[model samples]
Target: MFYWILKYLVVGPVLKAIFRPWIVGAKNVPKTGAAILASNHLSVMDSIFLPLMIERPMSFLAKSEYFTGKGPKGWATKWFMKGTGQIPIDRSGGSASEAALNTALQVIGRGDLLGIYPEGTRSPDGRLYKGRTGIARMALVAKVPVIPVVMVDTDTMLPIGSSRPRLVRVGMVLGEPLDFSRYEGFEDDRFVLRSVTDEIMVALQRMGGQAYVDDYASKFRKQAEESGAAPTSAFS
Candidate 1:
C-alpha cells in the first residue's frame, strides 16, 4: 500500500538519510497489538517522523482543518496527511468531538497503534505543558498500554511556522509502557483521569527533560495572543 511504499521505499529512506534520527528504547514498543503512543507535541513534523521510525503504521487523530483546505495546495496536503495514516476529526469540543473519540477507539479496537499528543497542541515554547485527560480516557477505555515517547530537538529541526526543515539530527526516546489496570472501571471518574494524565506527563518530563508547566499549551498560546505577543517562536 501507499503507507508501506512511502515508509520503506520513498519518504522514509530520504528522511532517515537527512535527519539521521536516533531512536532509543525502540524495543519498548510491542511488535503488535493495541497501544497508545503518548508523546509531547513539539512541531507539526512530530506526526510525520514518529510513524516513519516505527515498524508498524501509526494512526494519529488530526484536526479536520488539515483535510479541509482550498486549491491545489490543499489537495496535496490532504493526500499527504492521508498517506501518512492520519485520521481527520473535528477537534472542536462538545458533542462534535465524540466522533473523533469513536474513530480513535475504533483504531485501537482493530489492534492498531494509535498515536496521541496529550498536550492537544504543539508547544508555543519548548516547555512541556499539562496534558489532556482524553489520552487517559482512551487508554483506560481500550485497556491498552500507554507508551511515552519523547522527540528531542524536533522543534529545532522544524519549528512552527517554518516551511523547510533544518536538516539536523533528531533523537527519540521511548519509555517503558505504562499500565493503569488498577484504575480499571474508573475511566469515567474525572479525578482518576487527571491522575492518569499527570502520571503520563511525568514520564514524558523525565524522558524529555523539558520544563514542566502546569498549564495547557493551547491556554498558554491564547494568553500570549491576548497580550498582543507573538506566539510563533520555536523555543522561548
Candidate 2:
C-alpha cells in the first residue's frame, strides 16, 4: 500500500514531472513471473529512476547502512527505503555475503523482480566495470532470465558525491532477457559464473555504449583511494 502510494501519489509524480526520465525497450520486462533486473550502477539515482519507470514494483538489496541511521533524517530515509520495497542486506563478504545471497534467492522464490547491480558498487568514473558473479549465480540457482537494464546520464544528473541534483533528463535501456538455462547445473563452478557474468556485462555494454573496464569497480576505487588520485580506467 505504501509502495503504491509513494510511486503513484506522492514521490513518483514529483520525480516524473521533474527529471522527465525516459525508458527504451520497456517491453523487454516480463509482465509476470520471477526474473532478475541486472543494471549498471552509475549513480544512486539509478535505483530511484529504474523502479519509477517500470509498472511493476521491484526490490533491491540495499546496503544495511541505509536502514541503520540516526536522527530524524535517518528515520525518514529508512522509511522511504522500506516504503519503496528495498530490503536491507549487509555488504560484508563471507558469511554475510552468503546470507545476502540467500535473501535474494528468497525474493526470486516469491516470483518477484529482484534488482541487482552486478558491479557490486556504483561506477566511480561512469565506465562499465567487470560484474561480480553473484548475479550469475542467482540466475542459475533460480532458473530465471536476467534482463540487462542500463542507466544513461544518471551520473550527470546526480554525480557520485553530490547532494543536489541537476534538472537533467535521464533514461534507462532494457535489453532482451539473457537466459542461462544452459548452465543450470554449473552454478557451483566459478569458471561458469565468470563466463555468465561476462556475458551479461557484454550485453549491457552493447546496449548502454559505455566503455568496458576489465577490473572490478570496488577494486578500482580502493586503488584510487590508496594512491590519492582520481579513478581512471583503461577500456578493455
Candidate 3:
C-alpha cells in the first residue's frame, strides 16, 4: 500500500518528471518471474533509481543500519523502508554474507526481482570493481537469470555523504540476462566463481561505458581518504 502509493503517487512521479533519464535496453528486463539485477553500485541513489524505472517491484537488500538507527530520523527511515518493502541486511560481522544470501533466496523463491550490487559497496571511484562471488553462488542456487544493469551518472547525482542528491539526469541501461545455471553446484570453487563474476563485470563495463578497475569500492574510498581527495564520480 505505502509502496504502491509512493511508487505511483509520490516519489516515482516527481522523479520521472525531474531526472528525465534516457533509459536504454529496458526491454531486457523480463516481464515476470525471478531474475537478478546485477549492477554497479555508484551512489546511494543507485538503489532507488533503478527500481523506479522498471515496472516490476524489486527488493533491494539494503544495509541494516537504515532500519536500526535511533530517534525521529531513525523512525522515519524505518518507516520508509518498511513501507516500500525494502529489507535491511546487516553488512557487518561474520554472518552478514549468509544472512544476505538467505534473504535473497527467499525473495527469489517468490518469483520476484532481486537487486544486487556485484561490488560489495558503493564505488569510491567511478571505475568498475571485481564483483563478489556471492552473486554467482546465489544466482546458481536460485536458478534465476542475472541481468546486468548499468546506472549511468548516478554517482554524480548523490555521492557518499552528500546530504542530498543533486538535480541531475541519470539513466538506466539494462543488458541481456546472463544465466548461471551452467555453473550450478560449483559454488565451492572460489576460482570458478571469481572468474564468473569478472565475466559479469566485463559485460557491465561494455553496457555502462565505465572504466574497469580490479579493486573493490571500499578500497578506493580508503585511497581517497588517504590522499585527502573526494571520491570520483562516474561522470566520464
Candidate 4:
C-alpha cells in the first residue's frame, strides 16, 4: 500500500538514482522465513536505506519519540516512519525494555525480517561500539539466524543532526548468517547473551572495516553532551 508506493513510486527511485547504493552478499538474506539483520548503526539513514536496498521489507524498532512529537515536522516524521513499517518503542529500559523486546518477538513470530541495531544507538564515532545483548536474546528466543550487515558511508550522506544530506554513494555488505542454535536455551543467561552479541559484533567489525570500541556508543554521546563538545562521527 503506502509502503510500496513510497518505495517504488517515490523515495526508493529517487534515492537509488542519487546514491546508487549497492549491496554485497545479498543472497545471505533469507528469501522466506524469520531472521534478524543485526547491523552496526552509523547514522539515522542506516534504517532508511537498508530497507530500500533490500528486496524484502524490514521492520525496525525505532525510538518512541519518532512516533510522538508536535507540529508539522513531527507529523511528517510520524507518517514517514509508519509508511516505512517501523515500530516505535520506549528504550528507557526496565519494563519498557521488556515490552519492546516482546514487540520484536511478535514481529519475528510473523516470520518477518526484523532489523536491529545491536549498538542500541548510532555510533558517536566511526568505531563500532560494544553491542547490546537484546538482539542476541531475540535471535535465541526466535530460533532464527542473525545476519550481520554493515552499512557503509551512510553517515557521510546524512549524518546525525544534519538537516541537509549530501548526494553521496552508500553501500551495504551482508555477512554470512550466524546460527546460535548451540546457545538456544541459554538466552536467559546474561553471559551467554553477551557472548552471542560479541560474536555478532566481531563479524560486523570485519565486514564494516571500522575500529572496535569497547565502550557503548550511548556512553560516548552522554559524555560529549556533558562536556559540550561536538561528537565525532564518520560523517565528518
Go through the candidates in order and give each one's C-alpha lDDT: 0.89, 0.90, 0.83, 0.89
TM-score of each: 0.95, 0.95, 0.91, 0.96
Note the residue pairs that clash in candidate 4.
none
lDDT of 3 by residue, 78-186 (tens): 7877766678988774788898999999999999999999998888777888888888888878888999998988877887557577899998889999977788888
lDDT of 2 by residue, 48-165 (tens): 8999999999999888888888898789878988999999998889998899899999999998999999999889888999999999999999999999999999889877556678
TM-score leaderboard ranking:
4, 1, 2, 3
RMSD of each: 2.2, 3.6, 3.0, 2.2
Task: Flag regions of model 3 displaced more than 4 Å.
Answer: 226-228, 231-236
Worst 10 residues of 2 by lDDT: 227-236
Indicate the worst ten consecutive residues by lDDT in candidate 4: 227-236
Clashing pairs in 2: none
Model 1 lDDT tens row, 69-118: 78987888788889999999887898766777789999999999999999
lDDT of 4 at 216: 93
Candidate 4 ranges beyond 4 A from true positions:
231-236
* Global lDDT of model 2: 0.90
Q: Write the per-residue lDDT of candidate 4 for residues 54-133, one digit (tens) a residue.
A: 89888999998888868987888889989988999999999998999999999999999999999998887678999999
